[model samples]
Target: MGDSHTSHTGVRFELLGPLRALRDGVEIPLGPPKQRAVLAVLLLQEGRPMSYDGLVEAVWGGSPPVHVRNLVQKYVSGLRRALGDGPLLEWTGSGYRLSGAAVDDLRERRQLVDAALAARDAGELRRAAELVARAEELWRGEFAEGLAAPCLAAERLRWSEKRLSVLEARLAGQIEAGRPFESVHELVRLAAAHPLRERPVELLMLALCRAGRGTEALLAYEELRRRLAEALGTDPGPALRSLHARILRQDPALLAEPVPVG
Candidate 1:
């Protein structure tokens, strides 16, 4: 392989939303949707060869061609040309597979966010924030943007939920560190975007209380209670209810309490 091709062979592939390739600090194009789908399946099976039938099932469901193997090979050839050779893609007796060196963003994000949570649990708030920030930055809108497939759609929701969880944790950490004022604007934005999520509602209440706006905090909780009943036929969770009681009691402890890291 040419030096450039050899160096680029182990390009990281991201297929959680849209297909993206990162090699040498730049994103190499993975072509149109079908071509991207082909790469998605290959990346999904990274480090392990997949049979022709497996690729066909992943890409075409039950409508694959009799010449599925040959067609798959053609797609692989295009990817190899675009990706440059080294161990990017290979055909084997088992079928076809992308090399393990291909970076999987979903796996990486999970690890980074989990590590950050662990650090937070240990009271290493600064390092936890950095790790969570880095992980959240990995997301580029919906996974596989412009790519259409039932499989990708289903997978997108799973990744989106994980990303949201990470965001919630990171934002909670910021609030705990006395940065709720910085995140107040963000919490407002989140409330606007996700009116149903109770965590943001609680966080906003706490932020208001911390800023000495106890009256406003009580009003916010009342609004959330109304919204939850109207939209979800439910009440606030235990934490939010307890916080509301604290607000009502004018508990000095509420003001002195450390924001619990989530």
Candidate 2:
């Protein structure tokens, strides 16, 4: 089903996984790479639209063929066919726009997660978790994996990193809400998966410490320190350092009762 809003103009693309496009609960295949690339650029610039020239640059770098503009129009026609009669494209004086929703999947998810985190910080933890959970569910893998487009690479990394940060926020909220020692194992796995991310390491330490595994918490810190030095030639940053200081001082905050689950 479509969202609370009306119509199929509000299509969402889940490029993080296998480039799944959905219009009103129906899967819309975006066709071959060049075609998908055109649609991807359009979706990424929803509402604002892109000129034919701009899209040519996005899809074909600087040296598009003489027929490139017509090719782009054809691809847009194909996208419209797949996406239904919604206003997927609106011809502007200079360009075309993807009308409504103003979302690529990652952008939509970012908005959702950010809103949730804001709510959670304002003492609406349950609402926050719900939003973040929905956002995280949208990620299947790296964004647009097979595309070698230079512009999209930076965008992919930016979106992926934002998703990771929001996920960490959700986990931190879970820890605060007394989800249980089960989080410890997950934190450990996260630390292993992303050895360079100090937040997960610190979270793992906190989880162990709160579970009365202070020795293991310190050990976790040592392991992270070693890994950081060996892998990145650097130490944990200020946040991790502060966490270490808290552990050493045996700050009572470490022992404080978990926040009540909302």
Q: Best-fitting candidate, measured by lDDT?
A: 1
lDDT of 1 by residue, 152-233 (tens): 6666777677667677777778878877777678777887788888888788888888888889888888888898899989
Q: What is the TM-score of each candidate against the true structure?
A: 0.82, 0.81
Runs off by more than 4 Å, candidate 2:
1-16, 62-73, 88-91, 100-111, 257-262
Highest TM-score model number: 1
Worst 10 residues of 1 by lDDT: 1-10
lDDT of 2: 0.73
- Predicted candidate 2 versus true structure: per-residue lDDT over 17-127, tens digit per residue: 556676666677777777777766776785686887787777788777788878887888887787775655667878978776444565667688679968887988778
Clashing pairs in 1: 17-143, 17-144, 18-143, 18-144, 18-145
